[model samples]
Target: MLIISPQTCTEGFAYDRGSRRCIDEDECRTQPDVCRGDMQCVNQNGGYLCLPRRLYDQPYRSEIPARPEATAQCLLGYTPAEDGSCDDIDECETNSHHCNPTQVCINTAGGYTCSCTEGYWLIGGQCQDIDECRYGYCQQLCANVPGSYSCSCNPGFILNPDSRTCQDVDECEDEPCTHGCFNTYGSFMCNCDEGFELASDGTSCIDLDECSFSEFLCQHRCVNTPGSFSCVCPPGYYVYEDGRSCEDINECDTGNNTCTTAQVCFNFQGGNTCLDALQCHSPYVEVSDNQCMCSAENPACRDKPFTILYRHMDLSSGRSVPADIFQMQATTRYPGAFYIFQIKSGNEGREFYMRQTSNVSATLVLSRPIKGPRELVLDLEMVTVNNVINFRGSSIIRLTVFVSEHPF
Candidate 1:
């Protein structure tokens, strides 16, 4: 065994028992070279060792001096432990990290940080809301929530939980028709009132013509429109008591007359007419103020005297006159004893005469009165040549009569 002298015992040197030789040992305990001035030393079995640690100073060092202690090295996001060892501080759990309130925390190896929640993003260490709607994250529509989001359905739709999508509900399929039903934007509507029905296109309602089908309601024509119906009478007919029926018009009784002058009105079945009373006669004369004026100026005289005939009749009477009583006249002088003869009973019967004779003039005067209204028969015979004679020998005679009726 090699034994070393006590004076040859250098710092951190130890004796090997098996080899009997001195081994080089760590000089951390005896020499200050192992530990910096800020570190403390600890002695080991084979050698005295220096332990790297930090001391609590009243004023902490503004600048960290260079250190040879391995344990005294300051790591990122952590400081040395109070016992001069390195330890990590859970900044995330202790909430010591600066981050937005809406953010979440995550722990790392030596430090902690913040991040956004689900459906959100972290930008510049701050939480930002993500638009899930733009990314088609929702089945129908998506809404962004604070640090989160949700899915919903649009208007006029309902969310289907099984499918997680929106589905449309048909309002018209529910048989909602009172008269008829129409579907619109998320809703439905019924048709009009009882008298109305929905149109073919299903938007508008139109009135039914009850008058057309039932006769007791309307007595005449029925007209139907969008919402109502009307009843009307025929032409030339007026509404009756029912306000819908028609009645015939009496034009004559209503004083609707269409007639000409000098004519008699005769009412017929539907209308009236005007009749000429003297058209059947050869010399037709019109009576005005109970007098008949001759239409022609003169009559042709063949031999001696000429006679003119007149009929006294009512214009409005529909009767006619007899034709056998008109004849020629006989006369000799201008103013002889003028007389009117009347046959009383038979053809050759008693006669009456007048004694007076008036002056000759354009007007002829009857000497005597006739008993009944018969045809006047006159015969005029020429007496001598007179100044009234001409080559043509034409004459016009006008007669005036005054009658007196005596009861027999």
Candidate 2:
């Protein structure tokens, strides 16, 4: 209704001055360059539309696939539709995007972008793996995942339910240590009871060798046992109540000495001695070799033992000293008993003389002259005469006289 000139028609319309109204414009047949070269212009009611052809299948413009028309403009991450209009490609939904699994797919106006989540950062167009352990994310330990991290604890500790803090594991609650368990930071220790020590593995207890240590209370010989010790002494010794000091025992006082009827037992400090029996008269003395003789006050002796002792003399000069050969004291309970003696057998009997000095005793004298060093053997026979009581007596006595040239 407001037409001013014939050229005032729209780009796709025609001018009809007779009807004075805008009609359909077929610009494709009139103006050949109404649309882009990569698109074909088609006629419409009031305008012209550009359509996609098979030759415009390429994504980017290049000189090899040159077009006779101007270059086409398409939206980012979009391709031309059949009506020559840009449309979204939906690369993420179609699994055609190059975004990593740890990155999120974002559709831009012209393209799509790969981005990390809230916990991750960008690195080289990819999500950067953040070591949460380096930043002390976990209380004790941390583990990095794809786009997040996990929290953990060290030994003897466990992660809390919140997954961000740590707490003690309570290893002692499980009865891990056989002895005693002490909890510490991220670890545990084993303690022993009295008189015991912990083993190398820190899980068990071992018995302490009390004797092996230098501070052992035992004073004497110590015997070691498991967690104990003992002190002892040798045989024939008595240990005190302290279990260390010892004292000798008196065997004589305890009646352990084996003294006979003829021997007397005398006890010293730690030992005993057995002495001979004093069977001599009041004034007589006991001589060496168990012999009895007359004293100055009293000339008589009694109850002498039946013993023969050898007298060694030098005979190299063929002469001998005046030696008393024989003597016998009376053992009869009744005093004043007559005794007679005679030689039964001997080699050279004439070299000896017999003397009957008293009725209770007798003596034999050897001759002072001898031929050479020789052993002499003699046998004597004795009998009690005029005895009030006939007592037990031996009638025979064998004597051996040894003479040597070396003053024996």
Most lDDT-accurate candidate: 2
Q: Which stretches of candidate 1 lie over 4 Å from their true place?
A: 1-88, 98-102, 136-143, 150-155, 162-164, 173-175, 182-195, 198-206, 209-220, 223-408
RMSD of 2: 26.9
Q: Write the per-residue lDDT of candidate 2 for residues 228-291, one digit (tens) a residue.
A: 6666655434667877554545566787888886786654323445656655454444565444
Model 2 scores a C-alpha lDDT of 0.59
Worst 10 residues of 2 by lDDT: 308-317
lDDT tens digits, residue span 1-408, model 1:
224444433344566666655555656644656767766554432344334454332222225553544345555556676555566767887788765787776765455655456555545445566655655656777777765557777775777875357777676687666466767655566777777877775656677776667765655577765556666664434567766665544444565556555754444322344445444223434355322333445452234223333322211111122212223243444433333322212222222222223332222223333443233332222122234442223222222121212101
lDDT per model vs. reference: 0.47, 0.59
The true-versus-predicted C-alpha distance at residue 287 of model 1, in Å, is 43
Worst 10 residues of 1 by lDDT: 399-408
Angstrom error at residue 269, model 2: 7.4
